[model samples]
Target: MCENNPVRFIDAFVDGLDLDALGFKRVKPKATGRPGYDPSDMLKLYIYGYLNRVRSSRRLEAETHRNLEVIWLMRQLKPDFKTIADFRKANRTAFREVFRSFVRLCRELDLYGRELLAVDGTRIKAVNNKDRNFTKASLKRDLARLDERLERYLKDMSEADTRDDDGPGGDASAKKLTEKIETMKARRERLAGYQKTLEETGEDQLSLTDPDARAMERNTRVGVGYNIQIAVDAKHKLIAEQQVHNKVSDLGLLTETADAARKTLGVETLDVVADKGYFVIEDVEACEAAGAIPFVPKPQRGSAASKGFFVKDRFRYDAKANHYTCPGGQELTQQGGKRVVRKGVHVIGYQNRRACKNCPLKASCTDAAFRKVTRYEREEVLDRMAERLADRPEILDARRETVEHPFGSIKQWMGQGAFLMKRLDNVRGEFSLTALAYNIRRAITLVGIPTLIDAARA
Candidate 1:
């Protein structure tokens, strides 16, 4: 009888024919002649850490020394903390490939539906704190403070110099103040250089702990360390994730994530849904061009329509004439051939000051001296999109149900709001592993454990 045997769980869970079958090896021929642990054992250690929600390397080291499941899984071998940490850090690229392979296997088994995908970005607290973020505005404030201190030091120095030779201490005080002023000036110049770098670099924000990460506001009252974006399939809620720098807004993320999912699933096209944040006109067009349908809400900024005033939409656009006919039956023509690009469409501005000033509805039409109306050259496309969304309002509700589930579950499981790894590459690698673990758990839950084992064997 195998009753009360602790090894049963480990044997049943992690016993494998060969780690090399999964493209992992225990030894490298190029390394020095030293006793090395098996790569399979390290892989098992990571899997155990992910499964038990002990993601920190140090914590995993502690578990290997004391925890029963870890002891059983690793065969009572306790690797040092440096070894464990080095393994994860050095093998990040290989681990990502392993994650991709698992995703491929899941698709082959028909686990991922690849029909309906929800795209969303959630803020993951970065390893860097908010205080480390150096924006141009912050740098300016720091320089201003330095300038005030320098002025005070100069004033003190001048006062000491004006002293009527009362004591030799006056010269010492003058020299000390002068030195302080020079130090403050040098600091100010350094800050100026930092500010110049901030301006020259296209990145809107930077992180001290992770140079590639950006500090972004998560909500009105809260700020996050980093923003991780994911596109999850509705069928099993398996994550298709990629970490991005926080500077870029969500408006451009829709097509990128959807395209990644399509490529991963080897599908020609798919349906994607997201909130208003992803609703850039160019992104919608790009998704369509990529053969994917994006169901994202158009962001509504308060316009004249919302304020109960005459909006540009009220005016009828004469496409052939390339002009607008106002409500008062006045013709508004394009002025000075000036145009601006909005949402990837050229918007030609039209105005008629003479007609607008004399119209009965001029007060409602213009708060400006002249009434101006801007028409997008591709307004017809936007109109069609709005109509389609109106027809299927339930898509929004579906988006909420599909995308929030995985985010909520992962956040709860992680216990903390931040990432453990510093730097963008490390964070991305960690996230990839987390996503793999999530997909595996989902697959195991949807299909029985025995079925997964059979598929793995097959």
Candidate 2:
């Protein structure tokens, strides 16, 4: 980065803050061993590196030797890659605190809009390769292939032995076959180990490269990575809160992210706008309970608009009479008290076979003799939320604008590939670094570096 550029603002900001006071863990002094690098210097080096778009620890170490700006930032002390890497690995909590510190600074500057929080999630690919990620099905297939290969080898050896072959070439072939068998057996054992691990941990899949990484989809492409949940403020389009999870979908993340943004901005009441994927009944209810008015577009699942069937949401739920008032003004009373749809979620089946028999809209509703509707006991909360959501189409637009911009900027900074770190904790710290760096860049762009420098000093 240029000496007089916004990079300077990062340096000034880091210089001004007492990292220890912000709960940044410091390396304890060793009485006898060689003196360790100062945590502040390492932090400054990382901040400077990330701000300048140089992310590799090796690159930072290289910068320490040759780059004038990095040398100045780290006070000419060139910490090796191990030291730098170890610092990041050991100080995960400290790195998170630094991200929050920058957020607090942003709040102090009144940069956060704070009111309209647009929540969304982006998939960040992990260092783990898709091929190295193993599922139960993959394990079974691999074992079958290994068994087939082993059987072929055994059959070939048996044929060779029956031919009474005793020449050097025959002996060599037999030896090679034996070696292949051993190798296959070892591989089979390794695969069995992976299978055992899967059974023991009860994980759907396991990534060999990065144990904590998971397989997820971004847009349409599926890969091993994390769902990086973020809540962006609509006013200035700044990220107010962030979380990284291994979950593949955003179904249950709405409330947690909105509430985190609420706490981060120190606001009692927050209005969160998110896409359809974030529309979960429990999450929506949680948001309202936490004083956040959520505007999430309901997900269209199994809605047969093309099939000419009215969607589930079109049917009005009457909480007072404990029945569903269908679009054709038919009352569907509960047939079952409660049925387990999935773990922790229960639903009651409502149906009116008599009403459907003579209804004119039955053709448009369903082809079955009776249309059955399932409702959760607490479905009224969602009905009320959807009623409020009906008039707030603009909130979804705001959500796209606010959240996508920061994701683009941050993705650019992270380079074409995903995280550089391996495991969850290290990746978290790495992401925290990226978040802080991006926020600093944004803060500098919003107000000039001069203003931020002044504020940091003040």
Candidate 3:
């Protein structure tokens, strides 16, 4: 190996870690049976494979025999693909600690700014195929089609029987139609069972290959996958924290992701920024409570926005007066009969019917007798976040730049567009290694390999 080879850094970095302390299995090795490969060697191999875009255990096994760098890193110990694969499956949870260890190393090297973190999520295709996944709507549609086909087959069988030819061709046609009806009936039974299971469990979708995977939209196309969230530091665009969840949307995930990054960065309070997908008020409040300042743009989603009417944001609320000033300068106080509970949230409606009766802006405001603007009890949290976002509009742009780099690199540059693992746990482990590899490559570029090796030794 050359003097500045990244292999040297990988070897040193893995050797310096206490694998047993990091929850790796078989770190001490058995004294009775045939000697096992050291956990450090296995970890080093995985890190090297992921860094070089060779994620499969079989590929790493091949590399040990063919790739000179792998030979040097493994010291000529050829572990088969099964052994290499078993090591990862057994130590799935421990990979996260190793990732965090490297994050700490980056912190020590001053690679993280620790002042700002950009949180975002991307959908990675799971091992399950789209056909193996079933949703309520999909099942209903399939069953309806099956019924239609079954009815058609029965009608054809009836017509064949009515011909009364008693010849060989007619009998064969009837038998084939019968077989098709039976097959369709069996399929209907299975789909009905899936519908029943969904009804019992109240889950929206079920995946046959990987039960934990969900059908989610990625770039406006639906696929079976897991949501992968990451928090990237603003300085070098390095990933501070990464997590895998089966959730379908990014609505309430901001606080958890940002808080984890704040702890990893070892900061008292960190600035967190994300896109409008994470504009849930409860999550923003929780992020604030966790000591992370969140800046998420309020999503323009309302019936008013869709109907070309004056949206709720156009009406300003007066804190002292506890009333809303509409676009027509009419005071909309809390009406008597408009209090309602929506989605377990107590919302109060405000409307001044007399003002709307003759107001000039009523044409654009509402076409009804009066326009009622409803507010949730805890909407003040959203108000505060809106104020914060108005002040630092550039942070949203910073978030786009900082977070998109890691995801783009992982999907395009790292060749991790789809996961090779089966379940959520395995994919989480896979992504931990992928993220670790990304950070390693980034850190190597920012501050050379020698600096990382020294930090690992210390």
Better of 2 and 3 by lDDT: 3
Each model's lDDT: 0.72, 0.82, 0.91
TM-score of 1: 0.79
In model 3, which range of ten residues has the least summed lDDT? 26-35
Q: Is candidate 2 or candidate 3 better by TM-score?
A: 3
lDDT of model 1, residue 30: 30
- Every model's Cα RMSD, please? 4.8, 3.4, 2.3
Ranking by lDDT: 3, 2, 1
- TM-score, prediction 3: 0.94
For model 2, residues 1-458, the per-residue Cα lDDT tens digits are 55457657767888888877766655433333768777888888888877778888788889999987777677778777877777777787677778777787788899997889988888888999999998898899999999999999999999998998998698888899999999999999999999999999999898989998988877799899888888888878777877888878998898887897798789899898888898778888889899888887776676455566888877777778888899989888999579886667788999999999999988889988988888886777777777777777677777788887889999875462589888887887888888777788788779878778777777
- Per-prediction TM-score: 0.79, 0.87, 0.94
Q: What is candidate 1's lDDT per residue for 323-400, written digit by digit as tens? A: 889888999998876466754467678889899777899878767787788766566655666667788898788788
Best by TM-score: 3
Model 1's alpha-carbon lDDT is 0.72
Which pairs of residues collide in model 1? 125-225, 126-225
Predicted structure 2, TM vs. truth:
0.87
Alpha-carbon runs more than 4 Å astray in model 2: 1-3, 28-35, 144-186, 302-309, 340-344, 358-364, 367-369, 413-416
lDDT score of residue 171 within candidate 1: 67
